[model samples]
Target: MGERLIVIEHEAEAGLGCFAGRLEAAGVEAEVVRPYKGEPVPGRAPAGLLVLGGAAAAWDDEGYGWLPATRDLIARAVDEGVPTLGICLGAQLMTMACGGTVERGDAGLEIGLGEIEPLPEAAADPLLSALPSGPVRAIQYHYDAMTTLPEGAVRLATGARYANQAYRLGDRAWAVQFHPEATPEIFASWTGGGDLPPERAGELNAQVEAAGDELRRTWGKFAEAFAAQLTRR
Candidate 1:
């Protein structure tokens, strides 16, 4: 009802944070379906789709029973020209669903604030065209990387470690490795489980906090652009 976008949330903590508010403010209602909590994923996205990030590897269908269905939904959305945005693990899933490859990065885990530079191709992109020309920092918290892109995907952005940072499949579907929706608190919660050293975690959290205004300004535009896509559809 009233311009809804189906959001596939992979985990509890990975739920829509800032993007939720941004979408609402842009007049796009987000209907989040949490597969990690046994919520069934729909077979299609009638209006649009937003697949959030998670800790699970993209190929671990056996581990995440709903992943196969989720992949199917992503493929269907892309095939039907639905507006879709996938972040982090969602990006990995989109890559794999569209005949790309996602593997554990040989460069190790890419966590914390990272720089992502928009490519020349992004200048014509609907979602990324408004991004700053130079490198912009975003919250990065993922181990697996998209090693190869889908056959027809347009590479939108790149980073130092991971070459495939952002890409657009078909016309409306997009996938980005960085976390545009992560707030400082949400990122802190992610690092709170002692996965990283205390000092490192604190440092990363501080960096995110310091960059809050910039992150909101940059990524909030990205989210609003996506919301506009949904509303237009």
Candidate 2:
């Protein structure tokens, strides 16, 4: 069969967005699977897997009927060395699915554009190595944090608010707490339409727009590196 990246979208609002163009530019085809719309999770691993963000907690399998199956798929993908990228809630699921811990952050909500500092270990990491050594600005919108990583997982990046900003499992699997794929429009839609105060939403929207160029520059390379890893495998 031809190569493809299977994207599991948990919500209609949190679709592929900016990541779609980047993956396409890297010559990686994406097949979005909306599990929230009754799409069944795949039984077998694809060439690559991308689990996007969502509103539900990682352990809320009862609330999201497909989460258990999705978690199983993530575990299988990692075990099989499939190139997998899990963002936000996806990362929490990856952590929980593989014997890690996910909990509501005691630091309260970490929402808005923020910086991620790459750990020294990230210098040699396949996906993170391509990123600059300095703090990289990324979109952050999550209430939960990964208190513990999966067994044998390598912590790639860390932040002040949340230490577990990014990690790698096996060789190809990656889980990131921030949203590298989010665009300013998406951020605005999330903030402006949500319970965010009008002034707060406006401020974040401006920050997202201001940091747009840098975010794309850094995350575009990240997406390319991830695709390269999948190609090599």
Candidate 3:
């Protein structure tokens, strides 16, 4: 049977966009599982688990009651040796699952573009090591951030406001605060109000125009990273 990629989508339109497309381009079967819609509980594990970015917090109120259970699902996936990746809210959930705490960070609203600095030890990480120096121009959209690092997790990358931008737990599980898969639709839907300056509209428009190409190149790196985990199997 072909390998399966488990994706837990939290929001209505916050599903993986370019990330999913890139996986398909690589001939990898990517299956999206909508847990919030009462989809099947992520069972039997999978080759990997990708938690997409979302506005909803993992620890939200009764509106998202399935969140706590989703944590169990992610932990189970990790326990089963399935490489997992959590983005944005997914990253926070992963941190909490790994015994880390997530609280309202003082970073305030981290929107628009941002820079990330990889830790020294990250040069040895399988996935992170593949990345080069200098800042990776990725779209950052999040109100909450991780306050503590998860046990056995090394900080892969950090930014000015978000210290825990990227992290790796054990050998396979990973989480990133920024959205590498943020397409124009995803970006626009998540953005609003005077939170971000309106002057960035032109810049945002350009990014949207080049979304296809950007997604291809960026997701290529992500797929390469994920593929490394499968090779170890």
Candidate 4:
């Protein structure tokens, strides 16, 4: 059988939309496992590990019974040199598992479409090296922040509000605070009927709509690069 990318879905709404398609297009099979729906967290890491975003905070292990196991799975993948990608909550889990800290963002919730500034180190990084210079636009929706990165983790991307927007752990493990897998429709499902004011929500919608093409162009390359890395392994 072809190599499989294990996708840990924390929530039903936060499915692997664009990422799944891009990975499949690159000849990688994505096998989704919903731990939230009573699916067991794989004890062993697969060829590739993809942990999607979630509404729960990383420290909410008691609330989300599966978080602790998922975190361990991420740690094992990184330790064993598996190509791993974590988004939002997934990023937090990866960070925490790797001796980093996850805490609430005192700057409040960072929602809506925003630009992430890639650090100088990203110029030669494997996954982020494919991105264009200047601020990379991405969808953001998270209340938690990775306060401290793991030992020797290279910080790749930053934002005006969040300093730790992306980082590379070990060799093949990557964790991003932004949501590259989120499309406009998926983002709408996140912020459409929330407590956000109608005007603010509309503005966010317009911003995402305007930047949709660019997001796909840039993040698509990033996703494909991830898949390419998996294939190389």
Instruction: Tell me the whole-model lDDT of each prediction, alpha carbons only.
Output: 0.93, 0.90, 0.75, 0.92
Best by TM-score: 1
Residue 3 accuracy (lDDT) in model 3: 57
lDDT of 2 at 88: 96
- Residue pairs clashing in model 3 are none
TM-score, every prediction: 0.98, 0.97, 0.87, 0.97
lDDT of 3 by residue, 21-122 (tens): 556655556678787788865654567788877777767847777688778878887777788889898898888887898887786878765666888877
| Model 2, global lDDT | 0.90
RMSD of each: 0.8, 1.2, 2.6, 1.0
User: In model 4, where is the ten-residue run with the lowest total lDDT?
Assistant: 188-197
Top of the candidates by lDDT:
1
Off by over 4 Å in 2: none
Clash count of each predicted structure: 0, 0, 0, 0
lDDT for predicted candidate 4 compared with the true structure: 0.92
Residue 104, candidate 2: alpha-carbon lDDT: 92
Provide the clash count, candidate 3.
0
Stronger candidate by TM-score (2 vs 3): 2
